[model samples]
Target: MNPLVEVSHLEKHFEIRSGLWRTVSSHVRAVDDVSFAIAAGETLGLVGESGSGKSTVARLLLRLITATGGSVRLEGREVTTARPAEMKALRRKMGIVFQDPAASMNPRAKIKWSLRRPLVTNGFEHARIDDQILAMLAKVNLGPELLNRYPHQLSGGQQQRISVARALLLRPRLLVLDEPTSALDISVQAQVLNILLDLQEAFGLTYLFISHDLNVVRYVSDRVAIMYLGKLMEIGPVEAVLQAPRHPYTQGLAASSPPMSPHQRGRQRVLLAEQPPSLIDLPTGCRLHPRCPFRQTICEETRPELRELAPGHWAACHLAENLPAPQPRDT
Candidate 1:
């Protein structure tokens, strides 16, 4: 079957100006030639360092911000050139839950008001609105007593559950979860994560789960994609990419993340010599060559296209074949 979502050569560039005239000077390639797909009912975890264009990709996919150039298709319909009415209709098939629960809702509004807005706007039956709200609240494990309270009256966990509940009101097939649990406490985080997993199974929803947390990604994602400096460095099944990352960038990220077990805490890690380069003027050739420990002369002269290193696993690196085997991450 065809994928639920497909992106091709996705690119988003921001123009920067320096002088008083505000003349265009350079472009920051926030997302450059990135491409991936999410199969139906699949969660593709997008992981990267801050400012690596993870959020930018999400915005571009939803057309919350326009793309400089590329194609985004949802269920085979092109999104980039969609008309206003068409885009509005397309949005009904997808929903977004942002990282901060407090910011997602209006402080002045009651929880019921927030939940009812989407249903009312989408022309959901007016009489069934209250019943629908009640049902969705139950799915998120929230009680009706909180519905009359303001957003500030609820706990952080309660607020997030409400946000999730609101997003599902329209019965969307795709949900873009952008660090959905990052702001909650550890205990609350687990609760929210479990709720998301349960909801996905119950709803058969496809997810574009974006987060910096590898452990969370491992737990929720079937496949994971590693991104850096506005490019995809490695992508594959979660185990193949996380446990045995091939690209130096991926290796560096996997190593720096908190170890899974006490015994693995002291294991040696791949360390880069310097930080990432400026996006306005990215380094030539392989973007990662400047800091890659295994970079060779060829790496400095040519950019590596993503190639299959193992079955169903791909990496963009000149030394992927020559690099020493990586230690398996603790299961």
Candidate 2:
């Protein structure tokens, strides 16, 4: 069967206008052409620093913001250019869990009311709304006793859990989680992740988990995609790609993740200098080449297309094809 969601060649550009007449506008290449698919019952983590366009991809998929180019297809149906009515009808099976749950919720509304609001909007049976709310709340480790509390009454973790319950109320098969755990404490993050895992199994859900945390990506994802300067630099299965990173950018990121095991110590992180080049006037060739320590003459003149370097593994770097051997394991 085909992937549940297919985003092919999706691009979202912004025109930045500045100075005097405002005619001198330079475009911000927010999401320069990017593409990937999400399989049913699988989680694909999208990782990058701020402004790498991960959130832009999510908003584009939901049509919260219009895309300047490319197509977003859900269940093989086009969404990039979907009409208002069609988009609304299509949204019942799709949901997003925002990073800042407190901000996402209506401060005045009680948790129970907020959780069931989606059901009410989707025209769920009135008799079923209460039961649905309770069941959804239970799934997120929330209870009926807290139902009367407003967003401000709940703790940060509880608020985030409420956000999760609200999104799940729609029974959406596809979930776009944008930094869902970043705002919570570490302990809370684990709880939320576990809850998500249990819920995914129960519902056979597909996820597009976006975050700046590599450790979180390592924990929650089956596969990972690395983005840089609005472009995808590498993508592969989580274990193979993370353990044996190919691209310099990807390796740098992997190396930076703190050692989870006590025995694996003294790992040095590869920190890059300066911010990514301006998106408006990105480097002529490889966008990452300017800061890339492995920069070569060819990297300065050519943009590497994302291609398979090995079976089921792809990276968009000239050196990806000839990466150095992995350090020996302590077998």
Candidate 3:
């Protein structure tokens, strides 16, 4: 099966201005030289800390924010440079579930109106949209009564379900889920996840699941990508990368997970101190080397390329030699 979504050498930057006259200017490297792909019906989890540029990648892929560089392709169709007219044709197969349901929804619009917005935008007729809306609502386990209520009247999970329903109104092949469950309670989150799984099984949808929570990623993702600063440090099957992470950052993330039993506790979690460097004046070479406990002289002068450390596994680190070689993950 071919990839449903592909991004290559992607970059996005923000120009900063400071001082009394705002004369001091610099560029913040939000996303830098990133690349990845998602095969049809597969969920690729993008995991990273708050400032690791995960959100930037999401916006760029959706074309909500223009890309400073690189390209994005959907089912081999180029979307990077698509004009307004061209984007309309491509967006029918793509949609995004934002992190915050409230921010994405119109305050004045009823649930039905909100749900039908995307479908109408995609050029569906009123009659066709009504049928699709009701069917989509049912698919998310929502009731017909919800269509008449405002967003405030609905529970958090309900609102999110409506968001999901709206996204699926067009039967998009790919959905960019940006921390879809972050704002909901655990019970609600579980319900949402179950709905997502059921929907995927039913629709055979491809997902780009972005989140900072490794635990959630473990459950929802088929594979995971570890990111730091503005680049991918490691990526592979969720089990392979999470159980035994090859990169120091990824290992740190795994170690951070509490052991279920006292007997299972021994690995030293990488303790990172001090805040990340300012993107406007990023450090030379590897940005992670500054906080990496195993940093060596070479780490400060030469940036390591993302290399295939194992079959379907990739990582970037100069001290990779000091760590154990990539061994096939035992499951």
Model 1 residue runs over 4 Å out of place are 259-270
What local distance difference test score does each model get? 0.88, 0.84, 0.83
Per-residue accuracy of model 3 over 1-331 as CA lDDT, tens digit each: 4798999999999878889998748888899999998999999999987888988998898888988999999988888898888898788888899889888999888988888777777677888888888888889998898888988998899889989988888888999999999889978999999999999999999998997667788899999998888889998899888886778777766665532123323342334445678787787888877777778888899888888878888889877657854433233
Better model by lDDT, 1 or 2? 1
lDDT per residue for candidate 2 within 105-184, as digits (tens), equals 99998887788788888889999899988888888888799899888988989998888888889898898999999889
Clashing pairs in 2: none
lDDT of 1 by residue, 98-187 (tens): 999899899999999999999999898999999999999999999999999999999999999999999998998899999998888989
Best by TM-score: 1
TM-score of structure candidate 1: 0.95
Write down the RMSD of candidate 2 (Cα, Å). 3.1
Give me the displacement of residue 137 in model 1, in angstroms. 0.9
TM-score of 3: 0.92
Where model 2 places Cα greater than 4 Å from the true spot, the runs are 259-271, 326-331
lDDT of 1: 0.88
